[model samples]
Target: MNAPVDIAKMLQPRPVPAAMLDALKARFGERCSTAQAVREQHGRDESPFEVPPPEAVVFAESTTDVADAVKLASQYEVPVIAYGTGSSLEGHLLAVQGGISIDVSRMNQVLRINDEDLTVTVQPGVTRNQLNNAIRHTGLFFPIDPGADASIGGMAATRASGTNAVRYGTMRENVLALEVVTASGEVLRTGTRAKKSSAGYDLTRLMVGSEGTLGILTEVTVKLYPQPESVSAAICHFPSIDAAVKTTIAIIQLGVPIARCELLDANAVRYVNNHDKLSLRPAPMLLMEFHGSAAGVAEQAQTVQEVARDHGGEDFQWATTPEERTRLWTARHRAYFAGMSSNPGCRTVTTDTCVPISRLASCIDKAVTEADEAGLPYYIVGHVGDGNFHIAYMIDPGKPEQRVLAEQLNDQLVHHALSLEGTCTGEHGIGLHKQGFLVDEAGAATVEMMRLLKRALDPKNILNPGKIFAL
Candidate 1:
């Protein structure tokens, strides 16, 4: 087990002066809240850190509202954290340093849709499902899905990618432009509607995965795709997890262009079956989707089926109808909740490590072995087509030893991944949880450069202080 750092000592909240609170309340009237319930809601996220709530919450309804609140905080030299739907898993929304949370949930709006250019502009609070529904009539859809009905701004902040990312790419590739509120509350625009640019630094890309440390995203313009002419979904059972992973690597190696390739171990399948009230074989399985022309979809499916069969896949089934496909995916999307349902009142220490395609099998195998040896309740799921997987260890919140064991397992897994030239996190950003691993993965000099950049942009260190790296 790695030596544990003193997390409590690292998170010291700055004073939120009464004058700052008064200024915020005066500027926004009833929109600024100091209610304990609201502050508590804005202070925490899906992470398991125990920190003091922010002094207040500001529900921003527009870009101007966000700018004004940020400007006030900047004047007071207090920390500011941005909040969306609160779906982030890496503690991105936690009020580690006391200040205010700029809740952008009220800014949900699809400002413009350029169907001719296959682009859509939206406010920060617009969700993936909401965006797709808003543009459904135009036969266009946003393909980046992080599986939490996550807000676009939050997704951009984390540079999230999910099932469709294997073919369509992540927020880093899809986001074309951003309207950001800098630390001084200055609204800056980056990128243009044109497909490519070489005029200056790619500031849009910089803010996409900065995790609210650099700035707050107010508006986003993202690329969209035309609805496929033919779409097909399927499920194939494998004899073991290794066989399932092998099949996925083969599919990707062959350049099959599979839209979604997800893996579920027997534990995950059982949880989803009991929770979703559906009967599925309690075995390792691959849930896949292919999108293209009718003939192209057929060819892709056939190629995948052959690869799976060669690796001992069985019970090949297809969901041709829209309803059937929805049922399966909805269940998959709810797998995290299902896992929680099986172990009520349990806190999970989830690991997200992505490796090179050729190294994925060894990485996952070592993880499964380590987890089994630890004797903790756990489950496995992954976007295997892109070489990313999650192994969530469910531990009792009241038992300190259990958490220690889980963290030890996580540490071992992350080091193993780093040894294989993989990242500490695949989709989830480094908020409060993986700061130590970031140093190990990127080394001290690289992380120092990041700190320098943060200090340079936010001299006051008021924008999301104590995140990504220490100031």
Candidate 2:
């Protein structure tokens, strides 16, 4: 392990500016809260990191409200952190530098849906499930599914992708435009509904994964897809992780156009079974889905089944009905919560890494071996179709040593992925947890260029201050 670095100082909370508080309260009235409960709730995220809460919370109902809050914060030079449903795995919403949290949950609205053009414009607070439900009757669906019913704005900010990302791509591809409020409280529109554009700078792509540091997204426009006429989902068990990964590689290499291919280690299966109360085989497993016409779906499934059998996979458990498919996916999406329930009151420190498709088997094998040797309580799951996976280290938060061990394990795994030409983060962005890894992955020069852009765009550093990189 590398030498321990002192990060406590960096996590220290800054004092709330009195003038900023008064100004916000005056402008937002009851919508602005400094109450203890509200502040506590806004301070941290779903991650295991404990942090000081924001000094205040502003429930923004429109773009104007967000702009007003940011303008007030900029005047005081106080940090402005954007908050959604608080589902982020990293410490993206932590008030490390105390400031105001602009909660956009009230901004949930489906502004527009261009069915013919296959695009939908929504307020930042709109959840992915909500967007899909609103468009379900139109025979169109938003393909990105990051498990948690996370806000679309949050997903875009993190550039999240999921099981379907192998085919539909991540937020980077789906998001077509954004209406963002800059640090200075000015609104900037990026991109358009047009499918492709080589126009000027790709600002939409830049803001999609900026993690709210560059600007606060008030609106997002994303691509939608026509629902497949026939859908099939299945779960197949593998003799070993190696076999499971190899099957996934073969399927991807063969270009199967599989919609979803998720992997769960034996440990993960056991925990989910105990927590979700379903009897799944205690082995490396793959939860797959096929989206196409009936004949095409059948052909794709048969091909994947053959590939899996070649890798020593067992008979598949099929979910042919929509209800059955939903149940199976619900169990998969709740894997993190099930992992948390493994040890009541235990917190999880998670790490994700994505390597080239060919190197995934070797990368995961090393991680599993090292983690088992450490004997730390954990769960492993992956979007293996795209070579991205996560390990959740279940640690008793009261034990400082356990947290230390978990961080060490995560660091080792990230460095291992980097050695294999992989990225430190796949879908999850560089929040507080992966700041160090960002430098290692992107190199000093590239990070400096990013810093220059951040400074040029947000001169006061009030937009999510102390994130992505230090000023």
Candidate 3:
């Protein structure tokens, strides 16, 4: 493993020449700033390492503004880091190349909601919570709920997915089209509103998870699902981890269309109990939700209950009321943050691996055992139904050796997952953190093909550079 450098350093802002700063000030006025506070906010993402910030932050208020900034950036030969909700888990927003930071928050607006077509067109800065609140009265909802109130563009860039992913699928599936500003400042639309097509190259799909490298996603069109007719959620306790894994695998094999099937280890349960102020037992637990018509949900719940019973699972304490369900899901969504709160003055290091239903148990079993042996302070949680899991490590930043060990263990977990014909990342795209593993996961030829495509789209490397690829 590479020797650990200081990964927790805050982003440092680069200084632009007076001529450039004056030009930017003339161009954007109050929207552009060289102040340290603003630059700091624009520089770092939610990732571990912090690097140099851009010379200035330019708040672009519209797609045209973004195109203008890109044109200026192309002329200046400077880095242009697209900023969204600042919730990325990788070092995606770091201005490693040093130039201008395009803060997209000002551009937030819902362009269109085609109820008949069941899709929404939104600007890059519109957040998930904001979008949901806007459409709350419409009876249709966007279902890709990543933990944070992340921007749609950022979520698309990262290819984020969460609890609902088991039911609604990830950005890769929901994203129908994108309006993008290329490296050369050309504004183009990739895909049509059609649900399915075999017409041309899959540019829409390609741009969905590009992490703002090939192009800056200015606007996005995503499919929406009709609100669930009947929604029911519950918590199920298991006697052991093995029992929980076995039951999860059984649910998948039985083909139950559960909306969410998440596993929370005893440690994670303890974290939530402390953070959310709940008094639940600290055992391996499952937080599940089922959606459908009343009769269908009832039948599915009954079958699930039976399977749980056979696997040493406990009672299903249901949450029927909207408030109760919201409270429950809110707790689940902040499970990792809750884990972090359990340790004062420490940050979280997350590791995720996904495998097939047949190998899920083996992958998680070994990971837990390895974490235990390493004496790591971490909590295990996951969307277990899809055979994917995450380990949230609350590591002390003062200790570099420990962080290296954590990374090594994570590498091993990825190796194990890949051994089962799984992926290193189930939802999180191959940002800077996962770049090295991409080659091993997708062989040399495939990696070469990916590089060629990236080159074709972003020959200048002015978009999010040094992400996924070494260049």
Candidate 4:
């Protein structure tokens, strides 16, 4: 069932002018790599979609490099795709249109830490864990954890949110400012160190989740949180999905201020236990964390426990020690890889949706039922506290039927969530996978407006062409 790939046809066979490549090589010297290995490496990501590699890969070390490369690309009308760590689940880094990829991984630097301002300015190549480690001594930590050690630039590009988003918010809320290299090769600084401002335009936000479609992010300044005095994590098993959903609803409605509240369906939990070698029960489970003063965390845990009990939750295990908490969350973060392990030699279509908190139960219940009836091997893990859940469908990529079915199931889930006033994508940006759904989620008029904005900024469409939406 392995399908033939028409890479050239898919890429539409766009030719990169040789003069531009020579100029880039001359300007960047050894940093400009036209090697096949480098092109292949920068062309694809964790996404399942396959595409031809870019014509060339430019390793950019600073904002000046990015601007220079972009300026040259603009001269040749060549598409420019920015590359970070390439951990993005969507095909955000793919050179689908046959262009050049500007890699910023070498730009890893912690530019500044204004501890008094509760903010840190960092290069785009800095990963979330890296930032936290760099600032750990400051007693302040960046809270956006998207499971993978994704670069800050990529995280901001995708507007990623993870377990902690329910409390501290996503890149949208945490990011304070940005240094962006526009399509015209001009550097624009958006936002300010000041917390609140009545600026002319919220350009920083406009670029935060632009997915490299609008411009390239060189530096990002993000708000950081003071380490909580007390932090506690808990695991609870539920008799059924109904009980788990109800407990989540009640917890959120009660305003528990839980730092992290994640749901692992029975199947997902079983896979996690197998992968992590833990002795957890094989049932739908909720992993939660509370951060506050010792007394406050204790009170929050007690309230959640009471709510869980009222909703038929059992096996309430609390992990207060650092070691225990790390072990617990490590298992949780490994859920994606663990689930993939359950089905060897299969590709995963990891999709997510966010709904109104009140409708979380209905949306998840319907999705689970349909997936069960479809008999697809899948796992469901969610940041249910924020009404965002992920369904990763393990599909035999060689089989077209499995891929089609997985997409159909995803479409159903997305349409259902949209019907319930939810978004097609919660955290993962609209890369190649979710392009069609973008217009569906946002009306034709809205998407057209977005296109207008894109045309205005990247008039030549040389910036990550054929992403978000098509002209």
Best by lDDT: 1
Per-residue lDDT for 367-447 in model 1, tens only? 999989999999999999999999889999999899899889999999999999999999998888888999999999999
What's the true lDDT of residue 132 in model 3? 88
What 10-residue stretch in candidate 4 is worst by lDDT? 1-10
The sequence of per-residue lDDT tens digits that candidate 2 reaches over residues 1-471 is 443233576675666778878888898999999999999999878887767888899999999999988888887888989999999987889888888899999999999989999999999999999999999989999999999999999999999998899999999999999999999999989999999999999999999999999999999999999999999999999999999999999999999999999999999999889888999999999999999999999999999999999999996989999899998899899899998888899998888999999999999999999899988888889999999999998988788888888889998999999999999999888887888888899998999999999999998778887888787
Error of 4 at 457 (Å): 0.4
Error of 1 at 62 (Å): 0.9
Give per-model TM-scores: 0.99, 0.98, 0.96, 0.97
CA RMSD (A), model 1: 0.9
Clash pairs (backbone) in predicted model 2 = none
Q: Model 4, range 280-343, lDDT digits (tens) per residue?
A: 9999999999999999999999999999999999999999899999998999999988988888
Model 4 RMSD to the real structure? 2.4
Residue 390 miss distance in model 1 (angstroms): 0.8
Q: Higher-TM-score candidate among 3 and 4? A: 4
**Whole-model Cα lDDT of every candidate shown, in order:** 0.92, 0.91, 0.84, 0.91
Off by over 4 Å in 3: 1-18
lDDT for 233 (candidate 3) = 88
Task: Give the residue spans of candidate 1 off by over 4 A.
Answer: 1-5
Q: Which residue pairs collide in model 4, if any? A: none
